[model samples]
Target: MLIQYRRDIADLQQRIRNRRLQTFGLFGTPIALVATVAAGVGSKVVFWLHTEMPNPIVNTFTASAFILIAASVVQFWAEIGGEVWDDSGTSVRDLKLDLALAEERHILEARRHTAPTADRQASYKERLPPEIVRLRMESRHYRRLHLLMQWLLFISSAAISAVTAWYDPPQPAKGVLIGLGFTVTVITAATGYFKPRERAFNLQQTADAIEQHATAIELGIAPYNAPEEARNLELFATTVEGMRADQRMREQQLDQPQQGQQQVI
Candidate 1:
């Protein structure tokens, strides 16, 4: 179970890194290009505007350049807003809890191996609830964070692309504009390839299933309500194991790469 938790944490961290990279690429590159263009040609353009007679071509280029710059600025702002919402600390704390639970599980395993005693087995059982709780909580945290990132990436890409198209930058900045388009395309593709929303939904569903089974067992409800306490405990263990197995299957399916596309991480 701790091994599974570690995998989950690693997956979440990878997704976070991907999202940050997307945000940086989408926002930073365009801003830098715009700044470079402005620095290199700004004074000359301003002088031309003030001194030279305005021609249709010059007027069109000037308007297009300013519009492209404005669009880039807006795109940068949107990306920044998304980054602010991406609070990775929440997931980091969850990972810390998972590590602590893993350590406790290791200690219990060692004790049981050393003693092979009923008391040690009982101690191990006593530690199960907290470990399960930690797993469920971590899953839930990962789900929420991933969901947030998915939407952020989707909306930011869409908005930026639309703004870029509307601006339709002049020929001089065409390369930069093309680069922005490519960046948005990559970000969108990454979001779909990752399927963050699907991961979140699957994880949340698994967490809920685990919680329901655990709760039913604790309450001694049907399937776990037995005259023999030992039998009831056995059923509880079996149910939990089944739940974990199902979750692992779901995760495995998720881990499989999409057809014609390699896994990103």
Candidate 2:
């Protein structure tokens, strides 16, 4: 049963990843079209600003590289965020479960135990392996990094856009062209970063829920229910068992005597 749970969790993670990638792929074309049209319009305006009327070649080609680079960053963000929001739906459920467990634990402790506090404390004493703890820390680090990088891209694009918008760029036509390009960059960045980070939030919520459940169970307050959020419960269980096994092996070795006999003087 535990093995099956492990498999289920692995499968869920894979599904989420695949869905995110698929969404990004599907969105690529539309994003490309928007970028292309914006570039075309900017080019025409630049031409008109330089001459009495629009010159498509000078404006179009010059702005093409900037627009393309901006578009690439836009696409990168969309691809990264794809389908990550699906986990948000379960956030309420997990939070509710934690609250319910805490309430149940309190009532049970008051009715049956003189000191439920000790039990709760003991439950948390079951320390996770050093490696698992490290992994969890690393996961948080990566999440922060992802968010930071996205924001940096957004701010840079906005600054460039503002510069382009403010400068007359030879005449009104060139100014308009640069302004539009920057405007699109701002919009793309806003969409990518401000969008809900449901997946990461859900995972954190689930981890918290699991901890609460474990505590409640130890206090004899309520039954524990492992969340299927990230399917990490089984991994948690497996890690615990492995740690125990290592301890037992170490104990056995300590109890055994040295195999070789020493020579008498």
CA RMSD, predictions in order: 14.8, 22.5
Which regions of candidate 2 deviate over 4 angstroms?
1-139, 170-196, 224-265
How many clashing residue pairs are found in candidate 2?
Answer: 4
Worst 10 residues of 2 by lDDT: 256-265
Tell me how many clashing residue pairs each candidate has: 0, 4
Q: Estimate TM-scores for all models.
A: 0.46, 0.28
Worst 10 residues of 1 by lDDT: 84-93
- lDDT for each residue of candidate 1 in 160-210, tens digit (9 for 90 to 100): 666667766656556655665676677567666666566666656766776
The numbered model that scores best in lDDT is: 1
lDDT of 2 at 16: 58
lDDT of 2 by residue, 102-125 (tens): 555555655674445444434434
How good is model 2 by TM-score? 0.28
